[model samples]
Target: MILIVASLCVQILCAIHVIRSSRNQIWLLFIMLFSLLGCFAYLMLEVLPQHWNNRHVRTARAQVVGKVDPERAVRDAQRNLDLAETAANYIALGDAQAIRHRYADAESAYRKALAMGPGGDWGTQVKMAGVLFERGESAEALRLLDAAPELGMGSERDRRALLRARILADLGRAAEARLLFEDVIERIAGEEARCHYVAFLLQQGDRYRARSILEEVERRAKRMDLTQRAAQADMYRWAGEQLAELRKV
Candidate 1:
């Protein structure tokens, strides 16, 4: 009831803004028809541009759009590839498809990028390896990781390590997986590394340690704003589910 009322309130507010500010009337129709998503569009695209130019807001708006209309990205990427059959375009399409969980399509796209010689770069190799991992080709994924040159630091390094750790875990190399997870958790700041570690710990039957780490996740979450919390909502929900299951035994 409360959420519905808030939704209606926001829609009304955006409609008024569209009229008063002499913005496009199409936005008014959107607010009336699509509800909260419409309001979000107005606020992020129209209102924010006119009032603020914060970096965080821009990122948040992109993430929101991706969440609300994931397929639009895939379509855009596909269209780009259609217009110019370039290696970069294939990569863009592959990434878009991968985010939508279309692993096979992503693999195909990445493979094409690889066969293009110059486009068959190391970065594309890493991305193709990841999609292969998602497709359950764990051994091939590991091979690709093994073949890549050293990535010393940054998000790409962390991502590679994380993917390697998950692959190792799936391959029954628990010791190797644990070491990689421990190494990456110390380097990364986000909830994802910790959450992945917790899952690995639970799989190893170290429920005590898993619970402890999850409690840390909860503690960190308490310091975040609603948007930050929403970004990791699935992780928190999974942590809750794990905690509940742990209690059963």
Candidate 2:
């Protein structure tokens, strides 16, 4: 009886050692089931010899090289105009990809441009945010859009605000998005913004306001020539489509 108890105690110690040494759950379970033989087999075959040496190598490498900074790399790319231009082309292609719902490719292209540090280039940044939003990274898109105000003045800011508002609407923050759309309309009076704002109001069930806005946009577009009117007509057509689709739902 004493010998049996001693063997059991030895087996328990070996099992504990095996559990500590390896992360394999199956091995641990086996050791628990047939303690003596299982523990011995695990020690001999599973517990890695020279594990400390491997850990030392990894530690030494980490000491020599620290974490990579993506933003720093982007800054370096920004210093080279040629690279930045190439990144711009990539962003354009990304827009095309996004229209086709090729979200992965769109994301890859946008990230490449972002990595090029398109600093002060709000257009590229907004395009990147659009790709991110389409790819279901709406939170990150919002962050990028929110950073747009710091970039500078121009159409980029307007476009970024519009994109951000659209994302906010998608996330069901309609009230906040409506305020943003209204602000955008006030800052930049354009057929596109009017259309988007009207569509947004329509989505929120403000049909009367939406119709009023659409009528105003139509009246403004009618005073323009073929080229400008065609562009404005496109906005009205898109707005009409949005309204039709919403009603179907």
Candidate 3:
């Protein structure tokens, strides 16, 4: 009788835990139906796995959600902003809005982040410039990029240069844009930069060079690690689409 009572107590405790965790309702039934065994199974199969999921799985899920509902992050960031309107949170919101193609909203968010500070946030400045570029405000984008605080030599500088190249391309400064693009393409360039370079070459009637660059990008994409592929799936997809269009030409 004591053993049965202990089993029932364990089952009840497990049920309460699963409920509080907001886990599946089926877990409650399993615990109630099979007592201790059900509780053990539930803990092993669901609870433990939830606690033990690796970074890759979590990151993959986040990337999937970002693609599936890009606005989800924006909503989350907005909630954080409502809770505490911090500069970082506003930047996060701006990033999410930009990802969702809400350039106006993103610009507003970045401006809010900038206004909260003493001055000189190169990252936020770059982001706002990107939004402006997307909205076809290329001159303003150039101004912002030129005004950005120098962050020394590295990915940050490369990204700022890339933005400048894009603005130049849109402004029909092909010679300058091509030079910057070539400089960026020498290193481990992002897919966007690679694709833009290919597009630039195509515009100049350099089909062979454009095709070679696109082929290299596609080849590299095919060899990316699981985490990298997940993070860059959209860029790769866009590249593939562009490649198909190029091939058809």
Candidate 4:
């Protein structure tokens, strides 16, 4: 009896998900006609794949993989690069190498992408700048970002602004960096950006402003559901640690 009740519940939930998802009429027919197996199949094949593709789920899966083989990402990226030498694949290889702190390898991959692709490759340039910045080549990072074609609106622009700000900060151009950081924060208000800005403020001896910014990030993060928080786990953890350190001060 319990099994029958649970199966019925599954079918109802699957039907609701199908309706919400606008899946094909065939799936609805399958759910209606094939009973328990149909509902289970639909949940396994359809609903779960959608959930798994979510950013948080992908991050969690990557974390699990990272634990097992720290170098797996670099290896997988190389295999993909071997299969397809496209600009996109090279970018992926660069990102994977960057994660492993292989900045020289990452820089080479990004440069290859730029050389292989046509002119005005904004993404490749920006990625190369990131690797340069991480490797403490701040002057090169600034030059790359400045020379790249004007990234059009939205996230691309904000990303370039943030990187430029960081490079400026590293180069002792505090006023310029502060303005750029403020503009980026006003535009996107992303956690990573806020945390970075807070660090900048602290470095500049503005603890009050840093504390306020950190508080805002903490409040926003606390309000997110588990999945949303997990998607931003790295930034969230950074913000949390920064906030804790600030409180201690």
Candidate 5:
């Protein structure tokens, strides 16, 4: 009896999702006529694919993979690169390598990408800038970002600003860096930009502002799901630590 109730519940939920999401009317018939099999089909064919393609869902999956098997990403990226030396594959390898802090390997991969078919390309350039920045080649990173003065408009453009701000901070260009960081933080809804600003504020000895920003981040985090929180665990940990210390002062 319990199993039957649960099965009906699933079919009803699937039907609700089908209606709410405006999925094909055929799916409703399938769910109503085929029972559990129909619900499974709708989920696998319709729902799961949609969620899997979402960037947040993809990031969540990547975070889980990184936590469970960090080395697998690098290996998988290399396997893909081995299959095709295309720019996208190389960039994927660079990203995997960068995550492992293998800056030399990442840089080599990015260089190969730059030499290949025009990437999702400027994005590749920005990724290379990140690798260069991580490797302490701040000057080169700045040059790459500067070369592409017009990034049109997107996350990458915002990323460019955030990255440039970090590079400037590293170069002792505090005022310029602060302006860039503030611009990106205020305009973008990304926690990373805000976290970077938090770190920057700490370095500048403005603990008060850092605490305020982190408090805001913490408040915003209340609404996030487990995977989203897990994906940002490091930043959240650091933010918490900073907040605790600031409270002491």
Candidate 6:
């Protein structure tokens, strides 16, 4: 009888060890094989600790949510700005200054940043491009933007590509710009993207194609909210009015 009891105790200890080690499947298998001993081990280790930690983490997160403040956000932004200024040697101080909307300061910073390197860093390039655009140097901005790739850099890359297409159209390279806009629409695959593409078509006086694209965009926008629906309707109405004006011309 003592030998049987010793065997049962050994099985229970093994089960407990498996549960504590995070081997749930092994614990389950042993419980099924050893019955009551396995069940008691699981109750002691797996179930209790899992519930305890989960509750603790949730409580900690809830407390953290209450500690956020505007002062903290301001400090974080200032820290980021300082870091960006210190680390970005390849770009001009003028460019950095421009990013913060200090146009005169940005112009000086960009010149300095440009002097740091011949090959462009994405941030510096974008800053320079924006300055050129603001100064009405659209051609130079287009050239710089065209040379840059449009991936891996987040929304900045998408915005640059879209802006480049718009500038190309403005510069009378409508065919090339239209093709580029179409590519962007294909890549992004959403109602907003399609609406922009349709607007571009309408701007180019291709009313028929614009109408078709607008119809598709409208269909997709149905799955969105009333605000989105109203915006799309406005786009269509504007496109129609523009098309009519073009016809009169």
Q: Which stretches of candidate 6 lie over 4 Å from their true place?
A: 1-119, 149-160, 189-192, 225-249
Which lDDT tens digits does candidate 3 get at residues 1-249?
Answer: 999999999998898898898888999999998888899999899977875566656777888887788778888999999999999999999999898899999999999999997788877888999999999999999998888777667887887888888899999999999999989877635677888788778888888788888888989877777776776677777778878877988
| Residue-by-residue lDDT tens digits, candidate 2, 90-148 | 67666656655777877787777778864776666677788788878899888877776
lDDT (CA) for every model shown? 0.87, 0.69, 0.86, 0.86, 0.88, 0.62
TM-scores for all candidates: the values are 0.76, 0.55, 0.72, 0.76, 0.76, 0.45
Ranking the candidates on lDDT from highest down gives 5, 1, 4, 3, 2, 6
Q: Is candidate 2 or candidate 5 better by TM-score?
A: 5
lDDT of 6 at 228: 37
Candidate 5 lDDT over residue span 53-163, tens digit each = 777788888888888899998999989988987888888888899989999999999899889865446777888888899989999999988877586777767878889
Of 5 and 6, the candidate ranking higher by lDDT: 5
lDDT score for residue 166 of model 2 = 83
lDDT of 1 at 199: 84
Error of 2 at 150 (Å): 1.9
Output the TM-score of candidate 4: 0.76
Off by over 4 Å in 1: 1-56, 247-249
Give the clashing residue pairs of candidate 1, or none: none
After superposition, the stretches of candidate 4 with alpha carbons farther than 4 Å from their true spots are: 1-50
What digit string (tens of lDDT, one per residue) describes model 4 on residues 61-150?
A: 777788789899888888998998898889899999998899999999999988999978877888899999999999999988888887
User: Residue by residue across 1-249, what tens digits does model 1's lDDT show?
Assistant: 999999999898889889999999999988999999889988988887764555445556767888888799999998998999988999999999998999999999998888876643989899889999999999999999889999777988988999999999989999999999989988887889988889889889999888888878778878877766665567778987887777676
State how far residue 212 of model 5 sits from its true place (Å): 1.3
Error of 4 at 195 (Å): 0.8
Candidate 2 runs further than 4 Å off: 1-85, 96-103, 116-123, 148-153, 239-249
Winner on lDDT (2 vs 6): 2
